[model samples]
Target: MKITGIETFCLRYRMPYALTYPRGEYQEREAVLVKVHTDDPNIYGWGEAAMWGGPFSTTTTVLEKQLQPLIVGQDPCCPEFLWEKIYQETYYHGRKGILLSCLSGIDIALWDILGKVAGQPLWRLLGGFARPIKAYASSGYYRRDYGLDALAADVGKAKSAGYRGYKMKVGNLGAAVHSRVLHETPLRVSFQEDIARVEAARQALGPNLDLMCDATTSLDAKTAMAYADEFERIGVRWFEEPTQPENISGCAELARRTRIPIAGFETETNKFNFAALMDAGAIQVVQPDVIQVGGITEARKIAAYAQMRHLTFSSKNYSTAVSLAACINLLYALPNADFFECDADPSPWREEFLKSPLFTFDDGIVQPFDRPGLGLDIDEVALSQWVVQP
Candidate 1:
């Protein structure tokens, strides 16, 4: 079949609850979705990249102006070639962040289209592996009122749901919240706290629970080492992004001094940098964001590379359900798939936009989907209702 047309939509949906990560808080979600259609009379494949805003961020503008021109007439099935072409052409103008993020959405869509064209599911197309990927409940955002009770209930809920574990956010929150989570929760709990607070949290949470500190590109090598030192006392498992993503030497140094597994590169765009991160001798866990890391196509390659090096494949998950479902599909395809970062916040807009809500989590485990090509359909009505012109 020949190339046809690519349609792009930018939608903004208000969140049902506030989404507060370490960086900031957002009440609404803005996403850029691409629909690639051909004249060959088949279902169109869809890919979405929800851009978190800032200057030079991944926005709809990046998708339309920087990326569309490069791949409009290109064959959607030739994702590998198209991915390289877009990366090379945008190297000068939009290389690292937004450019790659926009291209990631297109690249994912292209792969989806290719899979449909070949009449196979995305996992099968990418070389199928049927390992049950463990999902960790990432709830705790909504329980701000109940705090420990919320944390305790959610942990219980996740374990009851069948999840092996859950992740609780830790910051400079006082000892009250920390005590309840570390002492009360029954299931294995993981903590995604800042590097600065990891030691204190680990000491409070104790040795049994898996403690991980996400520096979120916030710490330098020295600070990372300090956190690592504290983590050693309490036995934290991984130090995520102790230094900046570009600081390969700093990461290497931290990894050398600490026994903790260095997990990072969630913001890294493609496999080239991923190769560099692997080479850095710092990262033992690869955390690639499906939306930012070239969607399923590049994610699979990155995961494969991590597995080859005996690194754990832990992906960053917390977006709309469509992106979450896409990540799960990719996770299902991998052999070394580790914990999935599950979002516990309720998103009304996200739910309405999906053709079908993904498999619900039991305790903390989500059932693998057997449907073709991510198994999600875009709700046209919801899309139209939330469509953004600017």
Candidate 2:
């Protein structure tokens, strides 16, 4: 069926607790949801672009004023054609950042439509290699009044929730340091302090459960290598984004020096960038966010490329329920997918924004929705409540 109309919504909500990383702090979360209506009766598709720490308004503008117009009358079934059309048309003015992010939402929605038309789940439609993919609790950001004790408690709770593994944040100045001070100085934590937090989490989790840490690209290669040795001692699974995304050489060096696998590239926007990372032998695990990397179409390409290179493919998906659903579908089809990142922290939007449960976790394993398309029924009433009017 032909595309009829496209609508975009900007949702914003105050986070239950402020979270701090190496970059800064976030007190609120945001997402941009897209709905594509088709000519066929009773057939529409939904998708979301993560705006977690970015400007939702800018992404919304790109969706409405730029990308939306390009795809309104095209065939929703041909997501690849439309994806390329949007990318090539906007190549001069927009190839990355919010532009690609906007394209991502639309592309995912189109895939959802295609799945509905085919009467199949997205994963099955793609490959259907595996189901009930393993997941890890992605938590442990520095929060107000939160210390090592609090971190230990958080890990314990995730274990009790039946997660197989948990990921914690490192490289922040620590709970004692104010975010304002961090913004000004951006000081890296001492090696000793970083080790202490990981050790506390390990102790709380015990030796069996998997443990991972994300530095948010705050540590240099030298520091990351040193920390890697300590993390290995504590049985940490992997180190994520220890150095900036631009420092491909540094990441390569870090990977070479340490036995711990280096995972990153969430900030990358295209396959060419991923190829560069692979060519450099920089990252062992490639963490591509579907929305950030240009939707399912591009993500599939990246996953295939990672597989060809014999690299592990795990995605970075700690946003809204829509993004989580998209990621699960993509990962289920990928043979080499290691883990699906789940936010251990609570989010009202993830639970309350949808009429039906998008996914369920059974002892840290999540199964794909059997229903056609993305298998999500958006709660329009709940969505209206959180809509940011322009």
lDDT of each: 0.68, 0.84
Q: lDDT for model 2, on a 0 to 1 scale?
A: 0.84
State candidate 2's TM-score.
Answer: 0.95
The TM-scores, one per candidate, come to 0.81, 0.95
lDDT tens digits by residue: candidate 1, 317-341: 7766667767877877788888777
What tens-digit string does per-residue lDDT give for candidate 2 at 101-174? 88889989998999999999988888988656778899888677877898999899899988999998887754
Q: How far in Å is the alpha carbon of 268 misplaced in model 1?
A: 1.8
- Clash-forming residue pairs, model 2: none
